[model samples]
Target: MEFCDECGSMMKAGEGEDHWVCDSCGYEKGRDPEAEEAMETTQGQEVSEIIDTSDVEDKGLPTTTVHCPECGNDRAYWYMQQIRSADESETRFFVCTECEHKWREDDH
Candidate 1:
């Protein structure tokens, strides 16, 4: 991506053009988007140990409908945790009823 040197704003290319024009300061620069194409990168990531409770026979936890990423179960058990700052909302936890796959989502 090209940026303006005068105003430090992002620069854009015009139709049938070979230069980048600054939207803020009108500064122009040469651009070759094909040579600057982004390449995807991947690396081996370690899986951390997680506590799963799908096999435990407990009926006290609240149950909800959620698609399980592991076993494709539509029903799951849920809980909430305040795993953030005091001002932030709680994180909702879910465990698949069939496969016990655990996941969480933060309250917006």
Candidate 2:
């Protein structure tokens, strides 16, 4: 069994692939050589496609109704989708709906 880098969960090796998958955290690691190459190429392309959200209008973005659990700000709180994997890796951000305070949701 292998360990997920993100969540540190034990992963069982798949039958055909050399990769291991963590069932508890849904983390997949050790991709096939071809797949890894393709992913690398895709990542290079994505670097050029990064968008500046600061230029977007307030009305254009989807607002979530959750209050800032940290700041008690009710009027404008950013709702970020956190992707947590079995290896304990997570990516989350917060964009205050009212204050426009762009920050990582878990930074606090």
lDDT by residue (tens digit), candidate 2, 1-108? 357898898888766778788888888877566754565334664465444557345536655655665465654433344245557755555556555566665566
* Top candidate, metric lDDT: 1
Model 2 TM-score relative to the real fold: 0.32
Q: lDDT for every model?
A: 0.72, 0.60
lDDT tens per residue, model 1, 1-108: 667888988888865678888878778878776777664444432123234464544657888887887788899888876666779897788877787777885321
In candidate 2, the residue pairs with backbone N, CA or C atoms under 3 Å apart (3 or more residues apart, or in different chains) clash, namely 6-87, 6-88, 6-89, 7-86, 7-87, 7-88, 8-87, 25-86, 76-98
Q: How well does candidate 2 score on lDDT at residue 65?
A: 58
Off by over 4 Å in 1: 1-56, 106-108
